[model samples]
Target: MSTSTAPDAKTVRQVRPALRAGRFSTVLRVPALVTIAVMVALLLVLFALDIAIGDFRIPIGRVLDVLGGGGTRAQRFVILDSRLPRALTAVVVGAALGLAGAITQSILHNPLASPDLLGITAGASVGAVAVIVGAGGGAATGTLALVGVPLAALAAGLATALAIYLMAWGKNTAGGSGVMAFRLVLVGIGVNAALMAVVSWLITRASLPDASMAQHWLTGSLNKADWSTLIPAAVGLGVTLLVAAASARTLAALRFGADTTRMLGVKIQTQQGILLATAVMASALATAAVGPLAFVGLAAPQIARRLLRTPGEPVIASALVGAIAVLGADLVSRTMFPIDLPVGVVTAAVGGPFLIYLLVRTNRKATL
Candidate 1:
């Protein structure tokens, strides 16, 4: 004869924590899933709208037809050859920057942390500008110019990231403690200022034509987007994002402070190194594709966090928000302005005010 028994106090205690963790995960996941679905829908709409509204202004229906491989010659040429590449480039670059920003912000536990603010983009700009100046205006042509600029940008950006990391490193903060977030940001800002000065000086020294070309690129235009650049960038970013997604649990743990993260069995320094490198690669690729885009990185993750009501940045949602933001900015630049303005200009106008709001909000929270 067997007797039924209730769980003991210790068993209950362990089971209760597990149950609560499961419930909390479910609660967090549902909201994030819903947010992602909505953003995907919004991105699709913006993408269709972008393809439909150009010099020729094809109807949305026709745009769909073209996409489905059933449209007239002119429609096909305009959509496939002219408009699609630029729109896709916007999506790719925006997503890359957004993911990079989200990772940087979350791992560092700083809302203001972004590739732009941390000097990654500035370093890329310096490299790209150097290429333009070295090659002269028209001399930098064909495969070398096309490939050389991005490679230089990636190299320079990685070097800059390395510099910031070393400068931010301290004896006390070394070992398992990792670099402090605040110190990293301060060093990054100083590096960013210095790099921008170098870029300005380089431009000033160049000839009129070279300077104009560099200046135009520095403004971050999609006019340079081609299948050659876009394909490689998209593939690289996709792989990096996969790595980031796999590290999602580590990122979540990191937010709870170093002791808690260590308790959770995450090697803090190793994870930070991997995440920071992933972020730098993403940012460098995007900057290489389109010159350093301004606040897509800074704004998208914050916007996603608010929209999802998540305590930390939602990587996928932030990426979609970034794609929408850039695509929308590109649309507005193309349609709203008498002259087609650089997409960067439109983003800066919007992001400048958003930055101010963030500063004000952070100040208010501190005061309280």
Candidate 2:
């Protein structure tokens, strides 16, 4: 047999970079994978704890037994009828918000680009509050009121997102990266402020009982979590997450700037539009499920990115982190307070300090 010919310098150069890139990817993947595994374990623990620790404390063994369909009627009612739905709703809402936030931040290339700050949540609040006020202090019972709130919130949230996108779009700044991002955030803030004012006005005009109900919901309580709400929320979250998985490559490319993304054969505007739409759907669904959760969306992705040490937002990790955050916050609200506070209160308290930290850190880096 004849001896094989040696590779040329050109082939060697091409292969070297490919090999190096493969190794680099492997190095990144291992840590991220490990982090995800840990988060998954933590989520399971929190879920179980949430179910087990309540006014009537069910042991972990009893919780597991109830889950497996072997517990008594009382246990079944407690775990299956009451606690399970709330815990599951928390997980679904958290994951949806987290995923939405990750997608938003990645698309906008800004750490602060969350549905909460961008007026999407506020829009949902407007819709829900309007419905609550219209229902005469949430007295409107039956299927219409039950279904109407979520539908209204979803519609309003999507509308607000569309408005923000249209308002932020500028022919002159379309070519520039930083200008569009800054403009979008600024417009979002203005819109959010306007929406909050509208919510306040609606609440004020509402009767006392109605205003109380509206205010409670606005605080993002899980008191209304039942099978009816949880099922739809979970299904919507699952479908949207699948869409997000498909858009992963596009998101990664987007982080490389619009020019580079276009160079890589992505239809920049179209892809970004689709991703934004997906984010809006996810956020709206979550908001529909559990009113407006302030910082779960804003904080989850950044925490995940930092933990994973990934250059771009890690979608799955962000989801896990978000679910854990909300569930943990709910647990704290229920257990730590003299009276059970809304989950939103704890998140805002913690997230406020976290936001300030992020701002200070970013400023320091900019100065350097």
Candidate 3:
């Protein structure tokens, strides 16, 4: 591929000045902060609504008292035990998925690079299902399933990512970023399909009890949430997100082009390693917590980027936007009809069309 610009320069376009710094700078920080703050407030209001709109109504003051550990016993039991866990779970899982999507897309340089798009969720489901079918929900069994499932998913995903990345790099390591993006997404589709086939096979072999359990988990319900689940996710998310945020500037330069980034003093191998590790951990941890809800990462960052309209990755906006996406999808699932649909169904329904639109837009722009 010959690259030429301005009549004679060929073979490698210079990185644009705007994307060179690897940071958001003044242009991005202000609106990003405002968007993030609004998302938090909106989420809090939605959470309160989630608390209030349950089977019964509780006064806002009373809900606060209940949460603060000084309310009527029944009130305490209802709000403290029920809604709070689920709401907080939504926030954490949403953040994880959002961050996961951002880093995956940034690292691979593809808007469509989501865990669900790449089959990480399916891989996680397969692990979760094998546990359900083979191990019968004993304490040890649940523990092992919880531990084993996401690890398997992460391992499978990382393996798949590495394989695609390596194969793409072999053709021409120097200009492989765009090619890597294409290869990863295409191979991810195949990997995801293969993983789904395995999951189906497991479903076929499962005993009735196992089949039921696996089926429920796959539907992506938040009913299983608790502090036990929330704490681990929070810790995992906190660590991985910090790493990703710290790498924000590096990621910006990355989008400019790797060689440009390297010229600008970014350590290519190290940054890529950390980025992949962070993306994988954020994704694996979220998958462990909630069984993969389809489009938290993909939708959140895209939403944030559209709103922010700045150069480079919308890391912070993406996180806040992720929370909104998850909460919004869950709200729809909860109140869309008499029977609450699975959260995954809501996300899939919303994300699928949105994704098609993005693909078409990219295709048109490419042709233009």
Q: What is the full ranking by lDDT, best candidate first?
A: 1, 2, 3
In model 2, residue pairs whose N, Cα or C atoms come closer than 3 Å (at least 3 residues apart or on different chains), thus clashing, are: 137-210
Give per-residue CA lDDT, model 2, range 1-368, as digits (tens).
Answer: 89999998777653212225543432235666788999999999999999999999999998998898899999999999999999999999999999999998998888889999999999988997888889853554456455887788888989999899888887544554333777888899999999999999999999988898888888988987887777657876887788888887788898887678879999877888888887887788788777888889989999999998889888999999999999999999999989999998999999999888878888898899
Provide the global lDDT of candidate 1 against the true structure: 0.86
Which residue segments of model 3 deviate by more than 4 Å?
1-29, 137-142, 145-160, 173-179
- State in Å the error of residue 14, model 1: 18
**CA lDDT of 331 in candidate 3?**
73
For candidate 3, what's the RMSD? Answer: 7.3
Question: For candidate 1, lDDT tens digit of each residue in 173-272?
Answer: 3354458888999999999999999999998999988898888888989987877668656875897789887998898898887778989999988898
Q: TM-score for each prediction?
A: 0.90, 0.91, 0.85
Q: lDDT (0-100) at residue 141 of candidate 1?
A: 60
Clash statistics: count for each candidate: 0, 1, 1
Error of 1 at 304 (Å): 0.3
Candidate 2 matches the true fold with a TM-score of 0.91
lDDT of 2 at 274: 85
Ten residues in sequence with the least summed lDDT for candidate 1? 14-23
Where does candidate 2 have its weakest 10-residue lDDT segment?
Answer: 14-23
